[model samples]
Target: MRLVVCLKAVPASTEVAMDPVTHTIVRDGGDAVWNPYDTAALEVALRLKDEARAAGQEGWVGVVSMGIPATASLLEDALSRGADEALLLSDRAFAGSDTIATCYALTLGIGRLCAEPDLILCGKMAVDGDTAQIGPMLAAALRLPVVTGATTVERHGAAVDVEQVFDGARRRLCMHGPGVVTVDKDAATLRMPSIEGVLAARRTSVPVATAADLGADLDRCGLAGSPTQVVSCFVPERASDAVAIEGTPAEQAATLAYLMGEVLA
Candidate 1:
């Protein structure tokens, strides 16, 4: 079985800068970190790979991401965590992609994998975008069934059982293979890389594919392909409500005690 996980490299800092004209977050030349939710998805993939191997089946785990050249580093990190191969989709033509366009480019990249993936995994949502649309959209593009917000997934015969919290209840679902699962952050814990794994990952070269290599139409990628545009991007001003007790430590403590007593009374 071939399992593929879609990874994302998000800004490491909370204070992200956006392009005023494009209204897209600046991703180049910044320190990037793995999306925590995607990390959990990768963990789930790795566990499934282990199970497949133990059952004497062919198991391969690969990771794919779309970003600038710098994003290759995150793919290498996935290799360190036991992914067999990594592919990076990076091209200037892919800049300023909305959810639909992003999914379109990703669909092409996944097609370039050595073999058709039996299962595709992704985070329920990316922290940066928080749109939570990629998994379902990618599944649609691939003509596959998708289950989102999955907190647990396990192989069951020819199908997989997915469990998730829905409508304030835990629901389990069985879906056949050649499907997609959008994992919640609580699905699994990412394991630490071993020393040998780290060394090997450092030596592995991640392949980069561009729009041309994927035979992607210029009209179906990047801002051109994106139908939705961000009208505005800005941090909302926060209003604070609080009272400050100004005095030395003892005075402040007494004032706090009196307030508590009053409240209690």
Candidate 2:
């Protein structure tokens, strides 16, 4: 089984700022961490790989991400967590890519990483974006079947069984791979890296690719290719005030009623 997991480096701080002119999030000041949901996806892939290997079958897990050069550290983190290899698609041309352009670059990058991967996995959403669009969009670009919000997964040959929860309901599905799945947080817990894995990851230099390396069309890889435009981004102002009516139950109820009537009138 050859599996690939999509990873992301998101801002670690909740207090993120926006560029006044560009309307884009300011990402330079704070540290970055792996997207929370992607951790579950990675855990799922690692378990699947272990199962395949234990069955005397070949299993490989590769992690891929599209981000700036600094994001390579995130790939190394995935390596320590048990991925076999890591690839980073980083180029100045890929800066400011919206969901569409991001998926376009990833599609080409994944094609370069694995010619015929059995399964592709991604987090249901990235915390920074919260759009939950990358997995389905990448699947559409790759022309493969996709299942999103997968809470559990089991593989049998080329088929996969998936369970998901939606709108207070649970649904199970069976799908065939070469496909994509966006794993939910409920899927599995991420495992800690062993000392050996940590040392190995420290020595392993993740391969970084650029748009030219992936043969990406420059016109469709970044801001130029992004159709969605952010008109503005700012935190809404908030007001905090408290009023108390101190009296017996009946008096309090009468006061509340009077206040409501006055406000309505």
Which runs in model 1 stand beyond 4 Å of their true positions? 242-265
Best by lDDT: 1
Q: Give the TM-score of candidate 2.
A: 0.91
TM-scores, one per candidate = 0.90, 0.91
State the lDDT of candidate 1 residue by residue for 1-265, as single tens digits: 7899999999988999889988888897587999989999999999999999999998899999999999998888899989999999999999999999999989988989655898999999999989999999999888999999999999976789999998999999999869999999988999999888899999999999999999999999999999998878778999796779989999999999998898799
Model 2 whole-model lDDT (C-alpha atoms):
0.89
**lDDT score, candidate 1, position 194:** 84
Residue 193 in candidate 2, Cα distance off native in Å = 0.9
lDDT for model 1: 0.92
lDDT of 2 by residue, 215-241 (tens): 889899778888885767667999796
Of the candidates shown, which would achieve the greatest TM-score relative to the real structure? 2
Positional deviation of residue 155's Cα in model 2 after best superposition, in angstroms: 1.5
